[model samples]
Target: MAIAKLDVVALDCPEPRKLADFYAALLGGALVDDEAENGWVVLSTPGGRLAFQESPGYRPPVWPSTEHGQQLHLDLTVEDLDRAEKEVLALGATALDTEDRSRSWRVYADPVGHPFCLCAG
Candidate 1:
Protein backbone atom coordinates (compact mmCIF):
# COMPACT_ATOMS: atom_id res chain seq x y z
CA MET A 1 0.00 0.00 0.00
CA ALA A 2 1.11 3.53 -0.69
CA ILE A 3 1.82 5.62 2.36
CA ALA A 4 1.28 8.96 0.68
CA LYS A 5 0.42 10.41 -2.68
CA LEU A 6 2.59 12.90 -4.52
CA ASP A 7 1.08 16.39 -4.44
CA VAL A 8 3.28 18.53 -6.65
CA VAL A 9 6.81 18.87 -7.92
CA ALA A 10 8.30 22.16 -6.80
CA LEU A 11 11.21 24.14 -8.24
CA ASP A 12 13.07 27.02 -6.69
CA CYS A 13 13.53 30.01 -8.95
CA PRO A 14 14.40 33.67 -8.75
CA GLU A 15 10.97 34.61 -10.04
CA PRO A 16 8.23 32.13 -9.25
CA ARG A 17 5.52 33.62 -11.44
CA LYS A 18 7.70 33.78 -14.53
CA LEU A 19 8.79 30.18 -14.20
CA ALA A 20 5.22 29.11 -13.57
CA ASP A 21 4.11 30.97 -16.68
CA PHE A 22 6.74 29.16 -18.76
CA TYR A 23 5.58 25.74 -17.60
CA ALA A 24 1.94 26.70 -17.93
CA ALA A 25 2.50 27.72 -21.52
CA LEU A 26 4.49 24.61 -22.34
CA LEU A 27 2.33 22.08 -20.47
CA GLY A 28 -1.13 23.56 -21.11
CA GLY A 29 -2.06 24.40 -17.56
CA ALA A 30 -3.66 27.17 -15.56
CA LEU A 31 -1.30 29.41 -13.65
CA VAL A 32 -2.21 30.27 -10.10
CA ASP A 33 -0.31 32.92 -8.23
CA ASP A 34 -0.66 33.23 -4.50
CA GLU A 35 0.74 36.55 -3.50
CA ALA A 36 -0.41 36.06 0.06
CA GLU A 37 1.73 32.96 0.24
CA ASN A 38 4.91 34.91 -0.34
CA GLY A 39 4.88 34.84 -4.15
CA TRP A 40 4.31 31.14 -4.52
CA VAL A 41 3.13 30.05 -7.94
CA VAL A 42 1.46 26.87 -9.05
CA LEU A 43 0.44 25.36 -12.35
CA SER A 44 -2.33 22.84 -12.46
CA THR A 45 -1.98 20.50 -15.44
CA PRO A 46 -3.82 17.41 -16.59
CA GLY A 47 -0.89 15.17 -15.77
CA GLY A 48 -0.12 16.73 -12.39
CA ARG A 49 0.65 19.90 -10.48
CA LEU A 50 3.86 21.95 -10.35
CA ALA A 51 4.74 24.56 -7.81
CA PHE A 52 7.35 27.28 -8.04
CA GLN A 53 8.89 28.92 -5.02
CA GLU A 54 10.86 32.11 -4.83
CA SER A 55 14.56 31.96 -4.06
CA PRO A 56 16.22 35.36 -3.91
CA GLY A 57 19.75 34.21 -4.68
CA TYR A 58 18.85 31.19 -6.77
CA ARG A 59 21.63 30.13 -9.10
CA PRO A 60 20.57 27.79 -11.91
CA PRO A 61 22.23 24.43 -12.14
CA VAL A 62 24.94 23.62 -14.66
CA TRP A 63 23.94 21.13 -17.35
CA PRO A 64 25.96 18.03 -18.40
CA SER A 65 27.97 18.44 -15.20
CA THR A 66 27.70 17.26 -11.61
CA GLU A 67 29.65 20.16 -10.12
CA HIS A 68 26.61 22.32 -9.45
CA GLY A 69 24.32 19.39 -10.36
CA GLN A 70 21.20 19.28 -12.50
CA GLN A 71 18.91 19.46 -9.42
CA LEU A 72 15.95 18.12 -11.46
CA HIS A 73 14.67 17.88 -14.99
CA LEU A 74 11.36 17.19 -16.70
CA ASP A 75 10.99 14.72 -19.57
CA LEU A 76 8.28 15.91 -21.93
CA THR A 77 7.08 13.43 -24.53
CA VAL A 78 6.23 14.59 -28.00
CA GLU A 79 4.91 13.02 -31.18
CA ASP A 80 7.18 14.98 -33.52
CA LEU A 81 10.54 15.82 -32.04
CA ASP A 82 11.41 18.28 -34.77
CA ARG A 83 8.25 20.33 -34.44
CA ALA A 84 8.40 20.35 -30.68
CA GLU A 85 12.04 21.37 -30.67
CA LYS A 86 11.31 24.40 -32.80
CA GLU A 87 8.39 25.50 -30.64
CA VAL A 88 10.30 25.08 -27.41
CA LEU A 89 13.28 27.00 -28.73
CA ALA A 90 11.05 29.89 -29.72
CA LEU A 91 9.65 29.85 -26.22
CA GLY A 92 13.12 30.50 -24.76
CA ALA A 93 14.55 26.98 -24.51
CA THR A 94 18.22 26.68 -25.41
CA ALA A 95 19.44 23.48 -27.03
CA LEU A 96 22.05 21.69 -24.98
CA ASP A 97 22.42 18.46 -26.96
CA THR A 98 20.66 18.57 -30.29
CA GLU A 99 23.41 17.99 -32.82
CA ASP A 100 22.31 14.39 -33.41
CA ARG A 101 18.89 14.56 -34.97
CA SER A 102 18.68 10.80 -35.14
CA ARG A 103 18.61 10.47 -31.37
CA SER A 104 15.35 9.61 -29.61
CA TRP A 105 15.75 12.44 -27.12
CA ARG A 106 17.32 15.89 -27.08
CA VAL A 107 18.43 17.92 -24.08
CA TYR A 108 17.59 21.57 -23.61
CA ALA A 109 17.87 24.25 -20.98
CA ASP A 110 14.92 26.35 -19.95
CA PRO A 111 14.98 30.14 -19.91
CA VAL A 112 16.14 30.00 -16.32
CA GLY A 113 18.78 27.35 -17.16
CA HIS A 114 17.19 24.17 -15.88
CA PRO A 115 17.75 21.14 -18.12
CA PHE A 116 14.90 19.19 -19.67
CA CYS A 117 14.50 16.67 -22.46
CA LEU A 118 11.99 16.38 -25.29
CA CYS A 119 11.67 12.65 -25.76
CA ALA A 120 10.18 10.67 -28.63
CA GLY A 121 8.34 7.65 -27.42
Candidate 2:
Protein backbone atom coordinates (compact mmCIF):
# COMPACT_ATOMS: atom_id res chain seq x y z
CA MET A 1 0.00 0.00 0.00
CA ALA A 2 1.08 3.58 -0.49
CA ILE A 3 2.34 5.55 2.43
CA ALA A 4 -0.32 7.38 4.40
CA LYS A 5 -0.37 11.04 5.32
CA LEU A 6 1.71 12.22 8.25
CA ASP A 7 0.04 11.56 11.57
CA VAL A 8 2.52 13.17 13.93
CA VAL A 9 5.66 15.26 13.89
CA ALA A 10 7.72 15.14 17.05
CA LEU A 11 10.31 17.63 18.29
CA ASP A 12 13.12 17.22 20.75
CA CYS A 13 12.96 19.52 23.76
CA PRO A 14 14.57 19.76 27.18
CA GLU A 15 11.21 20.08 28.87
CA PRO A 16 8.26 18.55 27.10
CA ARG A 17 5.74 19.85 29.60
CA LYS A 18 6.77 23.46 29.13
CA LEU A 19 7.02 23.28 25.37
CA ALA A 20 3.74 21.38 25.14
CA ASP A 21 2.04 23.99 27.25
CA PHE A 22 3.20 26.71 24.90
CA TYR A 23 1.75 24.94 21.89
CA ALA A 24 -1.41 24.01 23.74
CA ALA A 25 -2.10 27.60 24.58
CA LEU A 26 -1.33 28.79 21.09
CA LEU A 27 -3.49 26.14 19.41
CA GLY A 28 -6.40 26.88 21.77
CA GLY A 29 -5.89 23.69 23.76
CA ALA A 30 -7.87 21.76 21.16
CA LEU A 31 -4.76 20.29 19.62
CA VAL A 32 -3.39 18.77 22.79
CA ASP A 33 -3.69 15.04 23.43
CA ASP A 34 -4.93 13.51 26.64
CA GLU A 35 -2.00 11.13 26.76
CA ALA A 36 0.53 13.92 27.08
CA GLU A 37 2.77 13.31 30.05
CA ASN A 38 5.88 14.78 31.62
CA GLY A 39 8.23 13.26 29.06
CA TRP A 40 6.09 13.34 25.94
CA VAL A 41 3.38 15.64 24.61
CA VAL A 42 1.11 15.47 21.62
CA LEU A 43 -0.99 18.11 19.89
CA SER A 44 -3.86 16.91 17.72
CA THR A 45 -4.72 19.82 15.52
CA PRO A 46 -7.00 19.69 12.52
CA GLY A 47 -3.92 19.81 10.32
CA GLY A 48 -2.14 17.00 12.10
CA ARG A 49 -0.65 15.73 15.31
CA LEU A 50 2.35 17.62 16.67
CA ALA A 51 4.32 15.80 19.30
CA PHE A 52 7.19 16.90 21.51
CA GLN A 53 9.66 14.33 22.82
CA GLU A 54 11.72 14.99 25.89
CA SER A 55 15.47 15.21 25.43
CA PRO A 56 17.28 15.64 28.66
CA GLY A 57 20.44 16.73 26.88
CA TYR A 58 18.65 18.70 24.20
CA ARG A 59 20.57 21.65 22.83
CA PRO A 60 18.50 24.29 21.03
CA PRO A 61 19.26 25.26 17.47
CA VAL A 62 21.33 28.34 16.72
CA TRP A 63 19.57 29.81 13.69
CA PRO A 64 21.39 31.96 11.06
CA SER A 65 24.50 30.13 12.26
CA THR A 66 23.71 26.71 10.69
CA GLU A 67 26.40 25.23 12.92
CA HIS A 68 24.03 22.95 14.83
CA GLY A 69 21.25 23.04 12.23
CA GLN A 70 17.50 23.23 12.71
CA GLN A 71 16.10 19.78 13.24
CA LEU A 72 12.48 20.70 12.50
CA HIS A 73 9.97 23.54 12.21
CA LEU A 74 6.21 24.04 12.09
CA ASP A 75 4.26 26.20 9.66
CA LEU A 76 0.85 27.45 10.76
CA THR A 77 -1.79 28.98 8.54
CA VAL A 78 -3.52 32.08 9.78
CA GLU A 79 -6.01 34.65 8.58
CA ASP A 80 -4.42 37.71 10.19
CA LEU A 81 -0.66 37.88 10.64
CA ASP A 82 -0.61 40.78 13.06
CA ARG A 83 -3.23 39.35 15.39
CA ALA A 84 -1.72 35.89 15.20
CA GLU A 85 1.76 37.18 15.94
CA LYS A 86 0.51 39.00 18.99
CA GLU A 87 -1.25 35.92 20.30
CA VAL A 88 1.79 33.73 19.68
CA LEU A 89 4.14 36.13 21.45
CA ALA A 90 1.82 36.19 24.41
CA LEU A 91 1.89 32.41 24.46
CA GLY A 92 5.67 32.38 25.07
CA ALA A 93 6.82 32.47 21.47
CA THR A 94 9.76 34.78 20.82
CA ALA A 95 10.08 36.72 17.59
CA LEU A 96 13.19 35.30 16.01
CA ASP A 97 13.05 36.38 12.36
CA THR A 98 10.66 37.82 9.84
CA GLU A 99 11.56 37.27 6.23
CA ASP A 100 8.55 39.23 4.98
CA ARG A 101 6.47 40.82 7.67
CA SER A 102 4.60 42.82 5.05
CA ARG A 103 3.86 39.65 3.18
CA SER A 104 1.45 36.91 4.27
CA TRP A 105 3.95 35.17 6.46
CA ARG A 106 6.09 35.68 9.58
CA VAL A 107 8.52 33.45 11.45
CA TYR A 108 8.90 33.01 15.18
CA ALA A 109 10.62 30.69 17.61
CA ASP A 110 9.22 28.89 20.62
CA PRO A 111 10.61 29.24 24.12
CA VAL A 112 12.87 26.24 23.56
CA GLY A 113 14.25 27.84 20.38
CA HIS A 114 12.29 25.87 17.81
CA PRO A 115 11.35 27.93 14.76
CA PHE A 116 7.84 28.12 13.37
CA CYS A 117 6.08 30.29 10.82
CA LEU A 118 2.70 31.90 10.37
CA CYS A 119 1.52 31.95 6.78
CA ALA A 120 -1.65 32.80 4.95
CA GLY A 121 -2.50 29.41 3.69
Candidate 3:
Protein backbone atom coordinates (compact mmCIF):
# COMPACT_ATOMS: atom_id res chain seq x y z
CA MET A 1 0.00 0.00 0.00
CA ALA A 2 1.12 3.55 -0.66
CA ILE A 3 1.06 6.13 2.05
CA ALA A 4 -1.09 9.20 1.61
CA LYS A 5 0.27 12.70 1.78
CA LEU A 6 0.65 14.39 5.15
CA ASP A 7 -2.42 16.31 6.25
CA VAL A 8 -1.44 18.42 9.23
CA VAL A 9 1.55 19.89 11.00
CA ALA A 10 1.25 20.24 14.76
CA LEU A 11 3.16 22.28 17.28
CA ASP A 12 3.14 22.48 21.06
CA CYS A 13 2.81 25.85 22.71
CA PRO A 14 2.05 27.38 26.07
CA GLU A 15 -0.89 29.20 24.51
CA PRO A 16 -2.40 27.45 21.56
CA ARG A 17 -4.87 30.22 20.84
CA LYS A 18 -2.20 32.89 20.52
CA LEU A 19 0.04 30.78 18.36
CA ALA A 20 -2.86 29.74 16.19
CA ASP A 21 -3.69 33.38 15.64
CA PHE A 22 -0.15 34.17 14.58
CA TYR A 23 0.01 31.32 12.11
CA ALA A 24 -3.49 31.99 10.85
CA ALA A 25 -2.46 35.51 9.93
CA LEU A 26 0.87 34.46 8.53
CA LEU A 27 -0.55 31.66 6.43
CA GLY A 28 -3.66 33.53 5.37
CA GLY A 29 -5.70 30.84 7.02
CA ALA A 30 -8.90 30.79 9.01
CA LEU A 31 -9.35 29.52 12.53
CA VAL A 32 -11.38 26.45 11.74
CA ASP A 33 -11.53 25.06 15.24
CA ASP A 34 -10.35 25.60 18.78
CA GLU A 35 -11.03 22.65 21.03
CA ALA A 36 -10.07 24.02 24.40
CA GLU A 37 -11.33 20.93 26.17
CA ASN A 38 -8.88 18.89 24.14
CA GLY A 39 -6.16 21.57 24.36
CA TRP A 40 -5.96 22.07 20.61
CA VAL A 41 -6.41 24.81 18.07
CA VAL A 42 -6.38 24.42 14.27
CA LEU A 43 -5.81 26.82 11.46
CA SER A 44 -6.87 25.96 7.93
CA THR A 45 -4.73 27.32 5.17
CA PRO A 46 -4.63 26.75 1.43
CA GLY A 47 -1.42 24.75 1.76
CA GLY A 48 -2.50 22.71 4.76
CA ARG A 49 -3.63 22.69 8.36
CA LEU A 50 -1.46 24.02 11.13
CA ALA A 51 -2.49 22.77 14.53
CA PHE A 52 -1.37 24.02 17.90
CA GLN A 53 -1.74 22.07 21.10
CA GLU A 54 -1.63 23.60 24.53
CA SER A 55 1.05 22.33 26.88
CA PRO A 56 0.99 23.84 30.29
CA GLY A 57 4.48 22.64 31.06
CA TYR A 58 5.83 23.41 27.60
CA ARG A 59 9.36 24.75 27.53
CA PRO A 60 10.36 26.46 24.31
CA PRO A 61 13.49 25.37 22.50
CA VAL A 62 16.72 27.17 23.27
CA TRP A 63 18.21 27.01 19.79
CA PRO A 64 22.03 26.97 19.55
CA SER A 65 21.87 25.34 23.00
CA THR A 66 22.09 21.58 23.09
CA GLU A 67 20.37 21.35 26.47
CA HIS A 68 16.95 22.07 24.89
CA GLY A 69 15.82 20.03 21.93
CA GLN A 70 14.39 21.65 18.87
CA GLN A 71 10.72 20.72 18.65
CA LEU A 72 10.14 21.67 15.01
CA HIS A 73 10.97 24.16 12.28
CA LEU A 74 9.51 25.34 8.98
CA ASP A 75 11.65 26.05 5.94
CA LEU A 76 10.16 28.53 3.52
CA THR A 77 11.35 29.27 0.02
CA VAL A 78 11.21 32.82 -1.24
CA GLU A 79 12.13 34.66 -4.37
CA ASP A 80 14.06 37.37 -2.57
CA LEU A 81 15.66 36.80 0.82
CA ASP A 82 15.87 40.48 1.65
CA ARG A 83 12.22 41.17 0.91
CA ALA A 84 11.08 38.03 2.65
CA GLU A 85 13.14 38.89 5.70
CA LYS A 86 11.60 42.33 5.92
CA GLU A 87 8.07 40.93 5.55
CA VAL A 88 8.59 38.26 8.17
CA LEU A 89 10.17 40.70 10.58
CA ALA A 90 7.13 42.92 10.22
CA LEU A 91 5.06 39.87 11.04
CA GLY A 92 6.97 39.59 14.37
CA ALA A 93 9.84 37.27 13.47
CA THR A 94 13.14 37.95 15.22
CA ALA A 95 16.56 37.61 13.67
CA LEU A 96 18.35 34.72 15.30
CA ASP A 97 21.55 34.32 13.31
CA THR A 98 22.93 34.27 9.79
CA GLU A 99 26.02 32.86 8.14
CA ASP A 100 26.06 34.76 4.85
CA ARG A 101 23.55 37.34 3.65
CA SER A 102 25.04 37.07 0.20
CA ARG A 103 24.11 33.42 0.19
CA SER A 104 20.67 31.90 -0.40
CA TRP A 105 19.27 31.30 3.09
CA ARG A 106 18.62 33.07 6.39
CA VAL A 107 17.45 31.76 9.77
CA TYR A 108 14.96 33.50 11.97
CA ALA A 109 12.66 32.87 14.90
CA ASP A 110 8.93 33.37 15.05
CA PRO A 111 7.24 35.58 17.57
CA VAL A 112 6.59 32.68 19.94
CA GLY A 113 10.23 31.52 19.43
CA HIS A 114 10.23 28.72 16.88
CA PRO A 115 13.12 28.81 14.46
CA PHE A 116 12.55 28.80 10.69
CA CYS A 117 14.52 29.62 7.59
CA LEU A 118 14.03 31.41 4.30
CA CYS A 119 15.89 30.07 1.32
CA ALA A 120 16.20 31.22 -2.25
CA GLY A 121 14.10 29.36 -4.73
Candidate 4:
Protein backbone atom coordinates (compact mmCIF):
# COMPACT_ATOMS: atom_id res chain seq x y z
CA MET A 1 0.00 0.00 0.00
CA ALA A 2 2.72 2.45 1.05
CA ILE A 3 5.73 3.22 -1.07
CA ALA A 4 8.14 2.65 1.78
CA LYS A 5 8.32 2.38 5.54
CA LEU A 6 9.57 5.24 7.65
CA ASP A 7 13.09 4.48 8.81
CA VAL A 8 14.49 7.31 10.87
CA VAL A 9 14.13 10.99 11.55
CA ALA A 10 17.60 12.50 11.40
CA LEU A 11 18.91 15.84 12.57
CA ASP A 12 22.06 17.64 11.60
CA CYS A 13 24.33 18.91 14.34
CA PRO A 14 27.96 19.90 14.73
CA GLU A 15 28.60 16.80 16.79
CA PRO A 16 26.35 13.87 16.01
CA ARG A 17 27.17 11.87 19.12
CA LYS A 18 26.49 14.75 21.47
CA LEU A 19 23.09 15.46 19.95
CA ALA A 20 22.23 11.77 20.01
CA ASP A 21 23.32 11.56 23.64
CA PHE A 22 21.08 14.46 24.60
CA TYR A 23 18.01 12.85 23.05
CA ALA A 24 18.89 9.42 24.40
CA ALA A 25 19.15 10.78 27.92
CA LEU A 26 15.84 12.59 27.72
CA LEU A 27 13.87 9.87 25.88
CA GLY A 28 15.36 6.62 27.29
CA GLY A 29 16.95 5.22 24.16
CA ALA A 30 20.07 3.27 23.29
CA LEU A 31 22.78 5.20 21.44
CA VAL A 32 24.50 3.36 18.64
CA ASP A 33 27.51 4.27 16.54
CA ASP A 34 29.17 2.79 13.54
CA GLU A 35 32.76 1.56 13.49
CA ALA A 36 33.87 4.07 10.94
CA GLU A 37 34.04 7.72 11.95
CA ASN A 38 31.44 8.76 9.47
CA GLY A 39 29.94 11.27 11.91
CA TRP A 40 26.72 9.33 12.23
CA VAL A 41 24.85 8.59 15.47
CA VAL A 42 21.57 6.90 16.25
CA LEU A 43 19.26 6.43 19.19
CA SER A 44 16.93 3.49 19.03
CA THR A 45 13.87 3.65 21.27
CA PRO A 46 10.77 1.54 21.68
CA GLY A 47 8.66 3.96 19.72
CA GLY A 48 11.05 4.91 16.93
CA ARG A 49 14.61 5.57 15.85
CA LEU A 50 16.30 9.01 15.80
CA ALA A 51 19.50 9.66 13.96
CA PHE A 52 22.05 12.46 13.93
CA GLN A 53 24.63 13.40 11.34
CA GLU A 54 27.46 15.82 11.56
CA SER A 55 26.99 19.16 9.86
CA PRO A 56 30.10 21.29 9.63
CA GLY A 57 28.17 24.53 9.84
CA TYR A 58 24.94 23.68 11.58
CA ARG A 59 22.80 26.63 12.59
CA PRO A 60 19.86 25.95 14.89
CA PRO A 61 16.37 26.93 13.85
CA VAL A 62 15.05 30.41 14.68
CA TRP A 63 11.55 29.57 15.84
CA PRO A 64 8.54 31.95 16.17
CA SER A 65 9.71 33.77 13.04
CA THR A 66 9.97 32.16 9.65
CA GLU A 67 13.20 34.04 8.86
CA HIS A 68 15.33 30.93 9.19
CA GLY A 69 12.35 28.64 9.59
CA GLN A 70 11.89 25.63 11.81
CA GLN A 71 12.82 22.57 9.84
CA LEU A 72 11.18 20.24 12.34
CA HIS A 73 10.16 19.95 15.96
CA LEU A 74 9.28 17.19 18.40
CA ASP A 75 6.38 16.99 20.86
CA LEU A 76 6.64 14.64 23.84
CA THR A 77 3.76 13.58 26.07
CA VAL A 78 4.25 14.02 29.78
CA GLU A 79 2.13 13.11 32.77
CA ASP A 80 3.09 16.15 34.85
CA LEU A 81 4.13 19.16 32.82
CA ASP A 82 5.63 21.03 35.75
CA ARG A 83 7.73 18.12 36.92
CA ALA A 84 8.91 17.29 33.44
CA GLU A 85 9.74 20.92 32.79
CA LYS A 86 12.02 21.06 35.79
CA GLU A 87 13.74 17.82 34.87
CA VAL A 88 14.32 18.88 31.28
CA LEU A 89 15.69 22.26 32.35
CA ALA A 90 18.14 20.57 34.67
CA LEU A 91 19.33 18.50 31.73
CA GLY A 92 20.56 21.59 29.79
CA ALA A 93 17.28 22.40 28.03
CA THR A 94 16.51 26.10 27.63
CA ALA A 95 12.91 27.22 27.89
CA LEU A 96 11.98 28.97 24.68
CA ASP A 97 8.36 29.67 25.60
CA THR A 98 6.87 29.45 29.10
CA GLU A 99 3.14 29.13 29.72
CA ASP A 100 1.52 29.32 33.15
CA ARG A 101 -2.28 29.66 32.80
CA SER A 102 -2.34 27.93 29.43
CA ARG A 103 -1.36 24.54 30.85
CA SER A 104 -1.30 22.47 27.72
CA TRP A 105 2.25 22.51 26.41
CA ARG A 106 5.57 24.24 27.06
CA VAL A 107 8.34 24.95 24.60
CA TYR A 108 12.05 24.34 25.09
CA ALA A 109 15.26 24.14 23.15
CA ASP A 110 17.81 21.41 23.43
CA PRO A 111 21.43 22.22 24.21
CA VAL A 112 22.02 22.78 20.51
CA GLY A 113 18.78 24.76 20.14
CA HIS A 114 16.37 22.34 18.50
CA PRO A 115 12.79 23.17 19.51
CA PHE A 116 10.70 20.57 21.31
CA CYS A 117 7.58 20.63 23.42
CA LEU A 118 6.45 18.90 26.59
CA CYS A 119 2.75 18.29 26.18
CA ALA A 120 0.26 17.19 28.85
CA GLY A 121 -1.87 14.48 27.43
Task: Report clashes for each candidate as comma-separated counts.
Answer: 0, 1, 0, 0
Alpha-carbon runs more than 4 Å astray in model 1: none
Sorted by TM-score (best first), the order is 1, 4, 2, 3
* Off by more than 4 A, model 2: 29-38
lDDT of 1 by residue, 19-86 (tens): 88788778897876455259688889988999988888889999889898999999999899999999
* Residue range 38-86, candidate 2, lDDT tens digits: 5777877656677888887888887756778777778888888888988
Superior candidate under TM-score, 1 versus 4 = 1
**Residue 81 alpha-carbon offset, candidate 3, angstroms:** 1.7
Write the residue-wise lDDT of candidate 4 on 17-115 in tens digits. Answer: 777878887898797654116989888987799988888889999877799987899999988999999999988899989867376999999888889
TM-score of 3: 0.84
Worst 10 residues of 1 by lDDT: 31-40
After best superposition, candidate 1 residue 104: deviation in angstroms? 0.8
Task: List per-prediction Cα lDDT, in the order shown.
Answer: 0.87, 0.79, 0.81, 0.85
In model 2, the number of clashes is 1
Which candidate leads in TM-score? 1
Cα TM-score per model: 0.93, 0.84, 0.84, 0.92
lDDT of 4 at 78: 83
lDDT-wise, the better of 1 and 3 is 1
Badly placed stretches (over 4 Å) of model 3 are: 3-5, 36-38
Q: Supply the global lDDT for candidate 2.
A: 0.79
